[model samples]
Target chain A: MFGFVNANPKSLSEEEKAIYQAFYCGLCRELKKRGGQKCEILLNYDSVFLALLLSGLYEPPENSFSFKCAVHPLKNREAYENEFISYAADIDIILSYESLKDRVHDGGALAYKKLLSSLEEIYRSSAGKYEDKAKAAALCVKKTTEAEEEKVSDIDILSSFTGEMLSECFVRKKDEFSEKLFSCGFYLGKYIYLLDAYYDYLSDRKKHRFNPLHLMGFSNMSDMTDFTEPLLTAYISECVNAFEMLPVLTYSGIIRNILYSGVWSRFNIAKKRYLSKEQKK
Target chain B: MDPYKVLGVSRSDSDDDIKRAYRNLSRRYHPDANLNNPNKDAIEEKFKQINIAYDQIMNERKGGAGQSAGRGPGSSYGYRQAGFSDDSAFGGFSDAFRRNNERQQQSDGISPEMQAAVNYIRNGRSSEAMHALLEVPEYERNGTWFYLASVASQGMGNMANAQNFISRAIQLEPNNPTFREFSERLNNIGAGGWYETGRAAYGNPYGNNSSSSWCADLICMNLMCFCCRC
Candidate 1:
């Protein structure tokens, strides 16, 4: 939901990049198919990662064709068509609707209600199809709000809720690999929650919003940068270890790059920014 | 089953090669990773065989080496005999207690509260142990308190807190081999190797003994009800 699930483009090979782009556009196409054109606006990197992970785990057959869309009217872009992409698109709509509802509740935008109402039918259909996933997402949102209201200081507790929610999303069906999927999803979710808190620490502190890393005894962003890098690195290592256990036959290289070096690339950028801000201060 | 064949390793394979092969095969056949396979039962059976094969080979190798070196720490038979005596009471409290006691400075004897927490930990009452530790006065907290707190935190799956507390324990007693070794284990968690061995040796903090998983399931069930309230 935070849109932190991005692959390191530099680390990807040309073919992998092409595959990545095709999938990205493929999600966009599915979003339009399921939720209409307006839903395309809700496309996020997190759902793309979801599609990639599912595709890797399921090893479903893929088909792609070049097509020109509104975004790229002059050039033909390859769009992947697959079951996982469609599933991820539906999930994207559900998450977007939930986030919009949250925004409406926070009193930030009354217009968000109009968008929510427009997406209500699509959201309900998707939610009905994936009842367990929808329930998990709703529960995580509810618990996260409760934690924020209660001002919970423990990073693990706060992240665990998010982790469990993502675990549910990763589980397409209750199969033998469900436990590994849950473990991988849990750690990645925890890493994202912590990363979001770290990234938003400065603004959250200024706005008097709840930030778990800030509350976890970190005096400033610099201290947070130092502490979270190692912790996040450990989580990534766990994720990779679990990932390696899965019998992924195709696109394993791409997934490996994203998990191993891609995540670290994002972390370094954030660290550099934090360090620069500290130097200025 | 031939241990080498079961692990898909050659008879001439080195220990590291055997270990690598086992790790790969186990990951592939692990029940969690093979749920959708039609041969789930077969895979599970094979996984058990692989585990048994690895253990047999390692034990045989250890036995041979132990005989050459005489009776000592390297002797697997001697070690197991020693372990049997320690495992008999409170699920092997003698070993853990003795190790902790050895690290205790001459003037810094184990407190009753510390002893009670250790007992709770041994009995799988991690929450109770955590509660007892929390009740200790701030000034009275020492390396032992922090070390035990790390164990409690690890049991709760709060690795961040576990890492912090264990690091504090190491800082307080820099030369304590047990503390340093535990710290290294915490640091290398999920990377396998020593971490796995340490977890098996010292006992799993997040094992079936903890009720946290049940609590989580209950909370999730209630939350599902709440979400479905139309």
Candidate 2:
């Protein structure tokens, strides 16, 4: 759920684009309102995607209004206001706070400590509201730390930890589509976990950081790509397959574009960057 | 059942249109196609309904009583009823789809070693599966064998070996879409290239080489640039 989820703007129509923007701005505004202006920095496409998915699944009444903001002071951009947006915003704050807290503890980074302190109240409130989700997230962090400490080498096991955490987050709302949503999030989470590991393999190796691919005996990027890319693609295909089965009414096209293509674009970006870096060497 | 509605076509649609619709829908709902799908049972049921619909429509058109006689819901119908017998134009699509499910059950009617390997891969024991595959006689290694070996290699993070095996699979069955797609992806990654080279020439960073996301970046860039210009 880190800012990897994005919609392919090309596949979106003007109205769909507006809807996406409204949701994005809407999440940002919610974050600022709930977690303060500083927390707005944590606004990401992943949260917006979550909001879009939940909204599409729930088919809630549309509630949007045009508003002028600092980024676009001259234009009154549409801002969507809804329960899902606020929920996503709160989840984002909690995640950011937890992530910052982990980084602060690991590296003793004073700046992160200060930021975490600032968001402490908001995090506490969000954690109270979503106790189960907060617990699941904390468990994920704990499991990840354990895996790193033990130097677990199995990519499947390591990625499943993150996948489980995300599955909990996605199925926070128990409904008819809960199972499908869980499966979709589970696979997407796995893809993200593997993609992050694959992307960081070289740097992690150089820094002697804990990378599952290196631990799994992949010596180079090409070898890593060959072994993991197919598995990653399979996860994406499974995610898309699950996504197709969900009975999404609104923004299905846009969501499909993101699932089917937008996520793949991120892979392409990583591939290009890796290729260019290799050529430079 | 209205075969036209089942195939999502109008009654006035030409034979070619009806055939095309049936082909597309059947492929989409095929049990083998939706193997990982949780709704596979429903899809399989829909596929049977589709076959029944197509058979009934074709039979009606041919002035024959259509194989609706004594064929229960769960009964298997031969692929020959699709009017595709001896027709090379369809490239035996119906036969391929029919055999896809059957092949899963029989493991392509190969020896126990091949079936064991397939079962191991299905159960997530890729190393054991690869071992089983290795024991197969070299001459007995066919497309299915190579494809399964490729999958097992991929599971073991041996992408180079996976690519080699999948290439062999593609060579044996060049017309297999699944094998071709797998080979194409393996080659693309092995070459360290994304999508196709033609797409890179068009200044599309994500290149339109693959069917998914083709021209996606170009269209997105143009749209954003146009909006910014305004």
Candidate 3:
């Protein structure tokens, strides 16, 4: 997804692309800084944007270095100073922990056990660094999984669970934008829940497994576009608006482009393809 | 910014008209339906107008009373409005209400995870977005996350996930016009009469035609597209 945004036709210049790559590389380095080498593997564009968004608060160091990694030794990329990179790394670790945790529960037995054993070492190390957040995210996922197991059909219950996880990531600055970030996470969590169900619908159906849509009896994807699009736009608008409100400055344009044009365009293509596939059949 | 104007109601329009207008605009701009429309400049304009108009009408209706704050006794007595409360003292309350709303708006920026989720969403990374979003703390989950995640999943061809997220959003902020519209849109899926009729038409006794993936997809698509557009 970040790759798509980086290459998107946004009328951006060569310099802008380089800056974007720097931010991306900065994020990658940060993941390594905070979570160690293994954590760097979880590095992705989203966390890079997080690094960029937070970058507004602090100035980047005067000196950046172009370094090669084991995977991309030939492709020299620019990385930011330690702190910016560190922030990105921390987020990666935290995010990776939560993601692996979710997977462990979602995947059955062998897969679950394998995930747990693999994650145990990483979780132990990262949890100490991000103690409270890691713990809170774990609890939230636990509660959420329990609810799902109990056949909890309540949408609010699950959304709140996701929202809780998002709230743990931020340091809660006194600035007004802090609250907006909270709201952004809130809505995004809700949107993700439904999308997860949608993506897994056929498989769940085939497996005769549980899905909220089946629980709710939803029939098709188009019908849901109406249900999902407006709230998304509203929240995205709010997130953008809040980011604009912040007195602190950094990478606002990059974040904004990714949110409005980048995200929306991708959604359009996906929906268009889905519709086209339906048409083809 | 007339409330009546926002709701597309006449100055003297009935409450029902105001309600109907709100519903119509809500349906039209409700995020779920307008997915991937490329953020048209007019849509934002329309949204602003509707919000302002609705706010104004709601204020007037809520605050208007005998116009007793001014004017002569007879005029004040005769000025009693039908819909508004008699307690006109709180007339300036709407300003405070709007101010609070503004403050709420000031708080909603995208987090790094949200940015990633959006990226994943754009790239059709439905599950990845879901996984990325899992990092967001509980208190942080708001209507925007749910909506965007839902849209992202939909783009990834995951309607069930979209429905689940949208439903969670609606539950969190039940009265949000956007959230409510989203929920309604999800509810309408697969429940359309046309699909049922078409399914009936394309029935197979021995083969159970509806069970075939191709037939199911076609019937669902046709019925959904036709029924929803209406």
Over A82-195, each residue of candidate 3 has an lDDT whose tens digit, in order, gives 565565566556666676657655665464455446556766776677676677677777877888888887554565565556544543232313443444444444444554
The prediction achieving the highest DockQ against the true structure is 1
Two-way lDDT contest, 2 vs 3, winner: 2
TM-score-wise, the better of 2 and 3 is 2
Worst 10 residues of 2 chain B by lDDT: B66-75
Candidate 1 structure quality by residue, lDDT tens digits, A140-233: 8899889988988888778878777777787787654565566567777878888888777777879777787766686777777768876775
Could you report the DockQ of all the candidates, in the order they appear?
0.08, 0.05, 0.02
Regarding DockQ, does 1 or 2 come out ahead?
1
Model 1: share of native contacts present? 0.07
Model 1 / residue B178 / CA error / Å = 1.8
Kindly indicate the candidate among 1 and 2 with the higher lDDT: 1
Q: Candidate 3 chain B, which ten residues in sequence have the lowest lDDT sum?
A: B67-76
How far residue B151's Cα lies from its native spot in candidate 3, in Å, is 23
Q: Return the TM-score for candidate 3, rounded to 2 decimals.
A: 0.52
- The candidates, ranked best first by TM-score, are 1, 2, 3
Runs of candidate 1 with Cα error greater than 4 angstroms are: A216-220, A264-266, B1-4, B7-145, B155-157, B189-230
lDDT of 1 by residue, B23-74 (tens): 6787798888899999999999998787667655654553332211000111
lDDT of 2 by residue, A119-162 (tens): 88989999999998788788888898898899877665677667
- Reference-based lDDT, residue A127, model 2: 90
DockQ of candidate 2 relative to the true structure: 0.05
TM-score, predicted candidate 1 vs. hidden true structure: 0.70
